[model samples]
Target: TVLYYDDEMLLELKSVVISNCAVGHGGRVIIPTEIKEGKLIIAVLQGEVTVLNTLGERAAKNNMVA
Candidate 1:
């Protein structure tokens, strides 16, 4: 769920496959262009990250030589 601070609402994208995630400049979560075309940005403030597999782990796995 992506939170919009402007309206204080949560937007959820269902059945969307996340192709890739990486650490962007200033430690932001960089969503690949193929996924959302740099449209949405989800920010996590004042709370713990609770995703099944984090972006860091996914980025590491993607960078690994298979």
Candidate 2:
């Protein structure tokens, strides 16, 4: 699952992908450590892939439009 956090709220999103990156792929969750420079850094617990908690430019643009 991806932990989505902003200034207002924290949301737990399961089986999500952002910026062409997959979160909790193959049922493995990369443990989130901290947020830096608009990216949430995660540690590898049992997987080879690392995913970040980023909203991506497209999502940000959409949010701005909305």
Candidate 3:
């Protein structure tokens, strides 16, 4: 499954895969969903984004958009 917006993207995957790239210009944040199963991994394939912490505060900023 896949979900996308101007500022967020998420995928529900249980295996490896590759997809085409369609860039969305005009800077926006990207929040990839957290997967509690299978020792969660994250990769920054392109662009920039802002991440928030558990306390609703700024965590990290930039480059985690895929």
Clashing pairs in 1: none
- Which stretches of candidate 3 lie above 4 Å from their native place? 1-15, 26-41, 46-66
RMSD to true structure for each model, in Å: 15.1, 10.4, 13.9
Candidate that scores best on lDDT: 1
Expressed as tens digits, the lDDT of each residue in 1-66 for candidate 3 is 222222222232122222443335754223333422333334433434344232212222233434
* Candidate 2: stretches off by over 4 Å: 1-55
Q: What digit string (tens of lDDT, one per residue) describes model 2 on residues 1-66?
A: 233334333332223233333358576544434422343333333323344454464666677784
Candidate 1 TM-score over all chains jointly: 0.29
Q: Give the TM-score of each candidate.
A: 0.29, 0.18, 0.18
Ordering by lDDT: 1, 2, 3
Q: Which ranking of candidates, highest TM-score first? A: 1, 3, 2
Task: Tell me the deviation in Å of residue 28 in model 2.
Answer: 26
User: How high is the CA lDDT of each candidate model?
Assistant: 0.44, 0.40, 0.32
Candidate achieving the largest TM-score? 1
By the TM-score metric, which is better: model 1 or model 3?
Answer: 1
Model 3, residue 14: distance off in Å is 7.8
Ranking 1 against 3 by lDDT, winner? 1
